[model samples]
Target: MVSKTIQTASPYLEGVYQPVLEEITARDLTVMGEIPRDLNGLFAHNGANPRFPPGAGHSWFDGDGMVHGIELNDGDAIFRSRFIKTQGLAEDLKAGEATYVGSLAMPGQGKRHKNVANTDLVYHSGKFLALWWEGGTPHELTLPDLETRGTFDYQNTLTGGLTSHSKLDPRTGELFFISWAPKPPFLNIGVASEDGRITRFSEVPLPGPRVQHDMALSDRYIGVFDFPLMMDFKRPDQKALGFVLDDETPARIALVDRKDESAAIKWFDIKPCFMWHISSAWDEGYEFVLVGARLDGATRHTKSGAILDDLPLVDGEHRFDSHPYMWRLNTRTGAVTERQLDDSFVEFPRVNDHHICSGARYSYMARIDINQPTLEAQGIYKYDLATGSRTDLKLPMHHIASEMSFAPRDGAKREDDGYLIGFVTDKQRMTSEFWITPADSIEDGPVARIKLPQRVPPKFHGRWVDAEAFRTA
Candidate 1:
């Protein structure tokens, strides 16, 4: 019997989201500027790179995960790319086609696949873990070569799964994360020690199943969102994991103690809004300050009212307006106050690695162009949290970039004393460039630009693993 071929109307199937058929390893790449000698580490970017075309009703989130990395040592850079080699990808490869439907597929219409491990990459406990945002077992990968080691289950100690945006406290070497599924005790919060041991796990009950994408962590507290956006299994018109902007559901925030399980988990009510990423969070006096991108409503369809899976391309109608905002939660009075931080359109926020669970002076994020056809960013924006000022690191016309990864210099003193690195794809040339810019002078352009051999698809989250991460492994 002849096998059927899949086709897709989704815009992600083409352009930067287009999948690369083969992997390549290149050494001593062409660099346009002086690579900082002190910048010694590996920058690994993880994204979706489907092996096969996802036919109708496919979502961009369904593609297989791929890691594109470059290692820098003493001003020298080497490039290597590889598929995450997840169980789902392996099964599909063995079948000679895609056996499982995408995240937006109708329930019971396709086989359920293992974790795609495509959304983000984190380095903790001396291992690089590739994670999926929708909850799954994180896949471990070795550095320098980007080899897939295997799945990590906390020595089979975890009662729940993992989130893509797990937080690692730089000072304590402890990892904090949360997990959620469509079942009772819908959320599970946990922490892992420096050596990858599950030390604390707690089942946080919620009213119902909600789409909780990211979390915020301060020195002493972990913040999880119970936003208004949730899954509606009764929506027949929208079959795939039915997502609806629930106005009736009140948005709330949950704060749990990072180290003490006996401490009460406090829940505070907030205005209805949606946020998919958190820039940073910290404690101040008696309040917790959380910074992130907030949208008035979920952006899931186009102006034509067509779902993302049915859209041919991402146009302005498909673009959702988002802005940086700061939320302050009072621990004593259960009072919540929020204010818009900036007016610019931005997302994929990042701060220095050393400031993950602490307060930072500045944040670097991708700036989106309103006229662009796709969500690909047009430049980088540096926001000063102290003065509410902004600096723009604009890219050349027709050029797009990825989320900035902040790499601090050796013996760096100040928080902003670091370099920002990320991939920039030039549509005019159909090529990609790896850029490095001083965290304080992003507007001055890259201090170094290493040319990539192939175009990397626009991806989700990545990390900058210092040399010490591998040394201790």
Candidate 2:
């Protein structure tokens, strides 16, 4: 059965998203436009690549992990790609096939699960971590070579799992993430120290299991969005994922102080919505503002062996789509004031890491083609939060882009005075290139278009790692 959303035998295995087998380390790569000499760093991306032929019940979330790195220094480029070599990928290699079920798989297929370790990469505790989207063990991988070392657990203090969209405070070197379960201790929040030790960890009270894809962290507080997208693994619905969207309970947002453990985690009632990612958060003089892309209803994504085209399009399309929105919580009176920021459909909103959790002036996001079934970006957007101005770096027709990462210029004093780096592929020509667009003048398009040896499939998330990171302990 063809996927309605992707319109293929398996959406994960077609077009630009298809996985490649050969891992190569090619140096002195060809460049179309001149690379900036001052822009010296690694543009690293983490993605999924199945080692062997998966079963009919295969899901993209369960694909084996892979990492790709493109290093730039003094106008020279080096390209490297390697599989993450997770224990799950090892098990599949030993069996000569995929042998694990996942949260997106058919119910009762098997109890065995694999932490696919393919969604994101975070440089924390002086090491690169390949994170899985299912909130499980993170595998440590080296940069430039992209070699997987082993799973990390913060000295065994992080027991069950870890979040993929974990936020790192650059000023304090504290990593903030979350953990959720189906049973008691339904949710856990953790803050890790610079030495890779879990310093402050506590359980947030919740009645049932939830899929908190991302959280909001600021200088003063941590914000958790508790949507009504409840989980029921035993549900018999083949059309929907293994869960029930509980419409009875209104969604809630919880806020807790970062330093004060005695401060109770307070839950504020809000209208029901499903938000997969939060762009940025900041502490105003009197209010805490959390901004993100929000869909005004529950979202049921793809499941194993299920055909999405068979589902009702009207009920699924807009329900799964999202828009930029903001919510402000008054510290004095516990009041919530929210409003829509823009009308454009976008996702993966990001700001400069140096301005993270601080008052950032601009946000970079992918402008999606709402007509497409999958989340494919037609262009990139630079939305100004301070002046309500918008700048778009539009790609040509039939060209798609991946998530963009902001890199501050070597001597950049302002927040948006840098470049945006991401991968772009032309579907018609079957060619992929790394584009570097000026952040301040994004409408000018790319200054450098580095040609790649291999097609970079649309991965989940990536980061700009400075050359200084390699010298750290």
Candidate 3:
């Protein structure tokens, strides 16, 4: 019998983080409101769900990858979920226990374990790619049903692995991604065609091993981030992912020309901070605009060993240092100006899929409420970049929502003419619900809420695969 000691000790391993026992498929789910007839696609979320209780020092991010999805067709919803079937998960199942430690616990210690593939999911070339933030090969999954296909290496064309936060160009149907390793030529950038073919792959060397999470893109250039937070694999005492924030290393952005892969990459120096995700970026005249959530200091480690300390404390007494900010870089004068756009605590910023790599009028993000004790978000916030206005769709107390993904309507004309889709977890009831809200009217709440069969644990990122995306693939 499996031991229950670990599950009872860690807060993350209990409650919603507790793993579900079986795969399920349920049809005709209960819906709170009318589902839009035009909203036809699959809302899929990727998260970690450990089958066995994790070992000591395991973080919430250390669990195995499980994908939970809901398919919408002609106003009806069908819910399904499955494990990612990675090599590591296979071994764990065979042993009837967890054999490998997680990134936060073991870091470089467990080199033989399988890549977990648990961070984010993207649909490109009519297939879904499961990704991890710390250098993992992409795992492919079929659309609609989300059946696991296998690992994708672009026909073995990729030298290094892929990053979790790859940028997809909606205008050209090109996928722009970056990867890093612990050696020289440690960083690489590549672009894949719409049909999942490697078109342009190049090595962009960085100073050392740095944690490059997300990249920003415009019509002409792609932005690669090199922040101070990095890993030192050679450190003898290093633990928990080997990440250390070096104040001496300044933050920089490398702008690579998309049209000319061999063009000299321009480097721009910015303030020293850490940004995990980028909402959007675009070029106007000679200035480039980049917007994302920024943290002035490392909040991962607090004086106390509380897991919620990593989150922005919002008790009205302790102000949050992490918030959304906009950075304007002038290419002509080498001048960079940054200003905070919102005071409220927010993260996982996403723009309309149709407006990526270009100017977007609206941005959607998960908002952390002051009343919540955990790090999970309590609501969704929609921000208008043009007027500097914000509207929130607050949830009931203790209810948590995932990162929002904007799905554009068919033959949609305006940028905001789409629906925002995400998963909401009711901790009190130990249930989950898939929600859909019109992008332009987020303040009005979800238009439809389909109850899910199982409680999906807190996850990192997800995507909406339209029916047409499969037809074209």
Candidate 4:
């Protein structure tokens, strides 16, 4: 029940002493039920030695729900954002290969340490760049191989409290991110120019800890939002269960001119808003941004005294649950719209012109609006903007879907209609599901659904590899 793929280059903690592996019997470690139920069960059995683990810090890691995508370059260079684990404290540190000990303190002790899993990393321009949340700082590694580089933190201090999600602009080769602080409470949509400089960092006043999740960019402007109250680090004691029982906070979409950084960012008044993964595309008349928010709380079925109770709760009686909705954002007039699907979802969203695509859980569709909630199906769903129509393909109950991408059709660029590609799982058979669907429409169903020979467990995100690029290690 341990991971075999992860290997270190130099001497790690395993070198300091004889590394011992033991089976976790008696379930001493408290399970907060953060990971998806199906994924949690698989990890418990298969035991993943992911590059980064949750409960630690935040980074775009390769584990379940962690967003990682292939940044198309010389062929396909897979890029993932994750918090690199290191041994020792601030002092007494020697850099080399070290076995990652995720927990600094023992389980029984009150101070249970977690690894850093909140940041995002990218491998581009012959270097690995890491972005952390705390300071919105950037850390770079020139070595192509990850192990030899050794772990490091950001050198620059982010002006705001926390740096949320970051996206790379393909056209300009720049980076866009949001910087905000909960204490003083202000948000800014920043642009990191090609020279690795903060070209335009504009601050906008907003309420405390809106905690921007994902953003979409069009030719004219970048659309951002204040996410739902369901997930917030502000009050760890705040109950997630209550947030799910009934939607508490609403999501709002804001527009900012891509060219005019000096102009005050315009706020669009959209209603019932709670989205997670987002992407954007543009046409002549208007710009379209794909956003996945939520229509309702997660469907839960807690036993009278279930194992969930044993796990450490994030806050008061908060059971682990999430629901993300996919919508289209119109920046010109500032209108958010989407087709009404009976089910709820929580996956990243993408757009292919008039068509919007996203990964989904089928169980969400099974729940009757009038009936009580329970765990069931998890699949992929596609929505059309012009028709306000939806198509559902049921995968399985426990399939943990992380992210989705749309590959260019034929030799067309991202601007044109492309094939929709998604990473999915069939945990029951320990199989990987990689399917390609037509971008123009899914009414005819997925063009081709290929199940990989090896089990891919579940993952966070993926990027499309342009055909012309030369991608070899």
Candidate 5:
């Protein structure tokens, strides 16, 4: 959608003042919702059957899944993992069986329509909570429906916003989630108390109505960044010219002063441009923030015009590595230093609030050894806080992963590194599996690969919920 304001040449300015100000006008831009239409013919069978396609081909909705948080409490495996079953349904439909709801396809490919919907189970204040980003209002599961113990709705209030990512404070046990408003286009940071009442709400600023894909927490402040949102409603041949190059852009980061809650606060910006998915950690008493930036500014919508030229593969030879950089943001001085990674870097960087696990989209085939025979360039680039050194391990290129969780080893303190758990996908099959790799040992293939019963689509973000805390027995 075009923004509400536009600027052009004006006769009121002379030489120096001419470039200083451009004539500005307000235009109402219409934005639409990307709602999924229900298809009558598709089957929703829960059981795995030859007739039913694997989770890959619309079995479970093709979208990201919230993680089954870390199992901290003692209990059986079922309650511990917090794996919510993907509800399945199946039916045969004739010509009129499926209804075309509308199109989510950008104006590009004749505007093809989207077919599925997504709803997820999130854990907050010690129980499983539900939220859906679709058209309907956000809903919550009742107390009787909760499989775990603990009080929710602390302030007897229900807070609603776009809940894509969240984190639980280890010390306070408070929940902080990233939310966004669709109608008015405002970002939000909401805090839910240990008892489940939302005590605070902070409005975060971003350029547009965007998805808060990733966030990192520090001892003093919460750092947030905005992800770019664009669609190709126009033909593929005309997509290159469809972007906003204006100078007035909105700021993405809002530094909330946890120390002074008395209305006076300060915010810091490392001046990241058109970036998405940031990871940060507190290492050796210093807070560091790292962000991934794509320079082209072109989005997946660019692929909508794929049929016109070449179909844009996810791993297409596009400008993936142009603006990717890793910066160290000083929490004390609010100063930032930088290092540039190879251009092809696009995967999410995993951090443990101390160390940054930088992954690169390149690999060496001969030197590194792993269980899989296939070559993997998507190696985990390890960074040490104390020494400031880096290492690379070839985990095999096909292992696409995100939402990495670091757990302490040998029942040590929560701050220590133990094991790393992440959801990985085998791109060939579009299948997802749980991987267990040591946080310190990058040399090993995930110690265990717990394969899912069916193909699971790639997901965005998740938290580690302690299983022991949710056991009914």
Candidate 6:
């Protein structure tokens, strides 16, 4: 599928990060092992796959949003993939070319950039939404067939853009999310009921506009992070990049009551660092503790305000070491205490969906390879938060992996009783495979491996949707 000597202008357009040109649907995929009868759901993921050649100053982040889904039920599996028909991509399809400017393009004041809806994939209220971290209208994709349904606006009351990180509490069936923008009243927090009602949507004023990739939700509180990264708008002499990492400012977290609508939100300052994802958060007595894979500063841009070409690298290598750490804020004294949980550098931290609200003792994250150039993972790390020990499920070299999607077993009692599913691309072969392993046993490898019909490029986050969640679709 690829040659060792293949040459491309951009490293992103080569190997597993390269775009695929097919939309496919295949039934009865061949599996290496027996499919679990108790497993019934879809492991759906979204990615940025450019339909045509990217525009000038094209960062790896710029592309058409594509969703790949594999549905399992009654010991059978089906696979499907589709390009999310976002308004921008639809126009490009009609014109038979790439029309929009790249992500690093300079736009004048009050101008807007294109929304690819390419960063994350989520399921809520029987609908699968393709989301972009840049804060834009979410595009909806249907199940079973993987078809585009158009943009979803939270029953039409959603006024501003929605980010990719919307935390859903499985216990109460309510989704807690925040949206950030570059304009005044920069941040807005929203809570939606199980049936998709926007119950409480209010503006949370900030000192200025910032970039927040993800948020955390606990049983009693919602955590909205404020890092040193901020949007640098266009100027006459300078080209406008999306964001810049400012070391002069401090990082803070705004904690809001999970259920109380009238409670005041408080901001607690922490060390100046940035985290693209949060692991798990909970309330431990008088402390509100949150764990994440932390970096010294934002790695997406350099000190000179130029956007980095590689989304998962710094200076074509592992520029920063990210470790899983926990931060505890004293609710009464307003003091912050933090510590490193492990020594390994990893990211894309996730817990069981049920644990996202109540917190869990275990967390599954992607192990970032120190010598890698792309966002490829060398393995998956299962961290025991209770004992501060780590177990690894390492992958073969040249296998670029995605985030582990935890699929709970039917009527399961334990948290890690289900399967950990993910898609990995063989960078050397340019082909893809779907892997499923027991969540409880980290060292044991995949129980089942299915070769995908299409090559899948390395991309961002995804979640496991239960079989019952797609009854309406």
Model 5 residue 254 CA deviation (Å) reads 2.1
lDDT by residue for model 5 over 1-473, one digit each (tens)?
A: 21211111211111111111111111221112211111001001011111111111121122221222222222111111222222211121122122221123223323112212133334556555544333212223322222223223444564555353455565776766666654344576677778877777777655565534445555566656654443233444542222221123433455565546554434455343444444443333554544454333333333223221122312111122333455666667867676655434444444453232222222111111123222122555554534445555454555555435454444444343555555555766655455556656666555555554334333434334333444331
* Residue 447, model 4, lDDT: 49
* Best-first order by TM-score: 1, 2, 6, 3, 5, 4
lDDT by residue (tens digit), candidate 3, 1-473: 22223645555567876778678899988999989988887878888788777653355666788888888888999888888888888888898877776554444444333578888898776668999877678999887767778899877766678888888998788999988776767788989888778888788768877767888998888889887665534445754443556666688888899998668888888887778788999998888889888876543432233223444442211223458899888877888999989888888889987788889878888886644554577788899999999998878776888788998877778998989998898888989998899989989999998988888887878888887777556
Tell me the spans in candidate 2 whose CA falls farther than 4 Å from its real position.
Answer: 1-8, 232-240, 300-319, 471-473
Error of 2 at 61 (Å): 2.5
Q: What is the C-alpha lDDT of each candidate?
A: 0.81, 0.77, 0.78, 0.39, 0.39, 0.78
- Candidate 4 lDDT tens digits, 275-305: 4444443333564544443433321212221
Q: What TM-score does each of the candidates earn?
A: 0.94, 0.92, 0.91, 0.57, 0.58, 0.92
- Residue 143 Cα positional deviation in candidate 2, in Å, after optimal superposition: 2.3
| Model 2 TM-score, all chains together | 0.92
Poorest 10 consecutive residues by lDDT, candidate 4: 38-47
Model 5 lowest lDDT segment of ten: 39-48
**The candidate that achieves the highest lDDT relative to the unseen native structure:** 1
Better of 4 and 5 by TM-score: 5
For residues 1-473, write the lDDT of model 2, one tens digit per residue.
21213213666677777788889888777777788887887878877777666544456656688777888887788888889888878887787666665445445555445788888888999888988777888899886577888998888987767878888999999989887776678788889899998888788888777777788888998888778676545445554344445666788889889999999887787776778778999999878888888876544432232223432222232243678888888877889888889988888888898777877779898887767756677888898988888999999888898778898777788898889988898888777888888899999999888888888777778888887787343
**What global local distance difference test value does model 2 have?**
0.77
Backbone steric clashes in candidate 4, count: 47
Give the Cα error of residue 243 in candidate 3, in Å. Answer: 2.7
- The clash count for each model shown is 1, 1, 0, 47, 29, 0
The lDDT ranking, best first, is: 1, 6, 3, 2, 4, 5
Worst 10 residues of 3 by lDDT: 311-320
The runs of at least 3 residues in candidate 6 whose Cα sits more than 4 Å from the true structure, single-residue gaps closed, are: 1-8, 108-112, 233-242, 300-320, 471-473
